[model samples]
Target: MLIVITSEEFVEDEINIIKRLLKEGLTTLHVRKPFFSSEEMKRWLFNFHAEEHQQMMLHQHHFLAEDFQLKGIHLKEEHRKSIKGKEQDFLEKIKSQGWVLSTSFHELQEVENQTLFDYAFLSPVFTSISKHNYEGKKFSVQQNKRPVIALGGIKTENIEKAYQLGYQGVAVLGCVWHQENVITSFKNIKKEYKRVYQ
Candidate 1:
């Protein structure tokens, strides 16, 4: 699987590029704008056709999942800790509704210990393209045993590397948004994902 993340700052014509990718068979999109309010997310997603809603996984304002019938809810560290008091109850609730659950991790050991998620993201497998001077962790994805998605500094050139290293999938941030031609860039990543894993 290949996943795409929204840039923290809006890029020009971002939604239209995303729409084109959906037509080209984009499956999962992680809407991770930490600055956006639920209303802002709703207003922005309103621009898309309703059929596309199932592909979106919101990183904030997860309640919007019910309103939009989105793919699922993604939790950060803070959100995950907040529900720790009633983790079982929360899990049951999401399961009853058939919502997908995902989270992010910076360390590979943490991923091995965690069993609550459908998939987890372990990032900085390479130096971050958008974050200044944040070096890569360089952990071997081949050692990972869970459904882990590699994030950070992933581009078409190195997508096959990620797969060979044993990642079930990859999530793109900088490679997709920072490019001059976003559609072509995403298409190339998708193409490479198929080449390596299919």
Candidate 2:
């Protein structure tokens, strides 16, 4: 799966750009707008076709996931820590309801967890294109039992490398949202992913 993340800052014509991405086979879209209120998030989601909500993965206002029939919920590091004891009940309920649950990990060692999440993000596999000085972790992802999608600095050139490192998927943010032509960039990345894995 190729996941695309929303820019922290909403850009003009974002809906159009996302529409094109979905058309180009984006399996998931991570809506990680820390600054957006629940109402703002709702409004932003409404701008897309109602069916598009099925592909959305939310980072906040997780209540909105059920409310909007989103694909799943993503837990940021702090949010994941907050729900430490309740993780089981939360995962059980979400699983019963058929929601995908995922989280992020900065350290590869932390990825060895008991709870089964559908996927997790292990980032900075390459020097970041969007975040300056956030160099690549260069960690081999072979040990993850849970599906781990490579994140951070992922682009067409290195996406294949990530898959070779044993990542089940790749998440792209800076490469798509910060590019001069977002749609073309997405198409090219998707092409590269298929070339490497298919």
Q: Write the per-residue lDDT of candidate 2 for residues 9-50, one digit (tens) a residue.
A: 869888888887887788799999999999998888888776
User: What lDDT score goes with residue 125 in model 1?
Assistant: 87
Show where candidate 2 strays beyond 4 Å: none
Give the TM-scores of the predictions, in the order they appear: 0.96, 0.96
Residue 154, model 2: Cα distance from true site in angstroms? 0.7
What TM-score does structure 1 among the candidates reach? 0.96
Q: Which residue pairs in candidate 2 have backbone atoms (N, alpha carbon, C) closer than 3 angstroms, thus clashing?
A: none
| Predictions: Cα RMSD each | 1.2, 1.2
Task: Write the residue-wise lDDT of candidate 1 on 14-132 in tens digits.
Answer: 88888898898989989988899888988988888778989998899988888888889999999989998888899998898788999999987888887888999988888899899
Clashes of each: 0, 0
